[model samples]
Target: MKWMEFSVHTAQEAVEPISNILHESGASGVVIEDSNDLVREWNGAEDEIFELSQEDYPDDGVLVKAYFPLNSFLKETVEEVKQSINDLLQHNIDVGRNEVTLTEVHEEDWAQAWKKYYKPVKVSNFITIAPSWENYQAAADDELVIELDPGMAFGTGTHPSTVLCLQLLEKLIKGGEYVIDVGTGSGILAIAAAKLGAKKVEALDVDETAVESARSNSSYNHTEAAVTVRQNNLLENTKMKADVIAANILADIILRMVDEAYERLNTNGCFITSGIIASKKDEVKKALLQSGFAIVEEQMIDDWVALVAQKK
Candidate 1:
């Protein structure tokens, strides 16, 4: 089928409005580039390698992407989508601005094309992400494995947040301990916890796509533990707790839920956190201390830190 390419140079400020318009208009997807031209996905794939990886865009500081397969309305009203985006950008009196471009694709198969870019990755010494399309060899006597494909959610263990969480989980989680992974992206952490010998594990993400990804990954591992996957927004039910909890979410969320996490842990239970920039480490530390969590261990890599703290 033919697809139309919608390109826009949108600042972070105008990205949301343009995204809302596209969503309301039933557009297939919209991709946004930040002020630095970094990649951000509003309604489509989350692969941002082009921004961070040099191989994809060797021409430094140039960020450009094409979104295709416009919905019926968007295809018919292509000019309308362009106008909405252009209007939103024009409304913002920012000095440096982005422009929008439109083009048509005679024929394309996005679903089949994206697979060529997806590859197997290893997050830890003990865990490897084998996409369903590739062959993964396990070391002799290896006890655990995790299998996944980049279907529709993040967390193939390639993201910094997921890797840091797994690193912290390996240390904080002992054999046969109960673990909770809030906002479990691809169930990567939950699968790792189960492999690390957690007697019971629970993984929940507010995003339904994430929940599905986690479930599929868990099943691929053939995990025996009760790795319950649910669609919950944090631990609203105060009656629950865990021996270990790993939340690799935004810094704002980590600070906001510090108290609830403290209240939701057994004495000596460790809480591991990641997805924090180095600049926000102090904020998290202060929140943890104020919430009665004693620092246990901390590690940082590539401008990201993961902290393991025990209940005081």
Candidate 2:
């Protein structure tokens, strides 16, 4: 079988969303090449060493690649992917060059193409995300591990947005709290919440593939007993009140759902949001405040920002 290798040149802030668009378009997996990663410093003897070549990365911004079967619907799928990516501009997301290119390759080539780009990453002080194929061991007694097979889904739990969410979840989740993870791609946050001692977790995503992926991941993490994965729009018709709610989606979607999140959280509950570009931080802050949330903590990493607000 043949496969289409699609590549996009986009800004760092646009990486997560664009990868998500690719996944929703039926890409089997994704590979990200960022110039910054080439120069990043690593600590600890267990950290994996990468041999990166300059030729593979852009001098600025990021390159995201995905693979899809070369089926009859390939052209239509590509057009839809491009249209969805272009739609990001309407929400004020910086898509950078937004240059997309495609190449054809054999199925064997696509199978191992993305593996080199993925490795176990320590996302937070206590959490590490490792691909299923990697051999990783916890360096600390307190560390927790999340085993995931990304398989075209969005959450690797290592992106700045996701790491910020995990850090806050570590701090905010008191034992026995109920948590809701909106747009739970890969079910990372929901599983983390469950492992962190949340009594119950409700994970929701609009994409059926994401929903299925989340369920599988929850089970893999042994969190299925505590986490429920469902296909539902963001917080729509969600009747269960939660002690903490996490949404690592775009700023616009987060803005639109602030009121619903505020309503669904219990008194003094925490609402953690990420996948917001730095420039839109204030805009999201304003929306949260207007919806009766008190901004408690703000975290910024590179060009992304994550805000933690409380229902007062």
The TM-scores of all predictions, comma-separated, are 0.72, 0.93
Over 258-303, each residue of candidate 1 has an lDDT whose tens digit, in order, gives 8888888889999998877676788899999989999888887555
Q: What C-alpha lDDT, on a 0 to 100 scale, does residue 164 get in candidate 1?
A: 73
Tens digit of per-residue lDDT, candidate 2, span 108-209: 777776666677877676788888788677778988888888665454566778888998999998799999999998999999999899999999999998
Backbone atom clashes (below 3 Å) for every candidate: 0, 0
Name every residue pair that clashes in candidate 2.
Answer: none
Task: Output the lDDT of residue 3, model 1.
Answer: 67
Q: What is the alpha-carbon lDDT of model 2 when measured against the actual structure? A: 0.87
Task: Give the 10-residue window scoring lowest on summed lDDT in candidate 1.
Answer: 41-50
Judged by TM-score, which candidate is best?
2
RMSD from true fold, candidate 2: 2.0
Q: Whole-model Cα lDDT per candidate? A: 0.65, 0.87
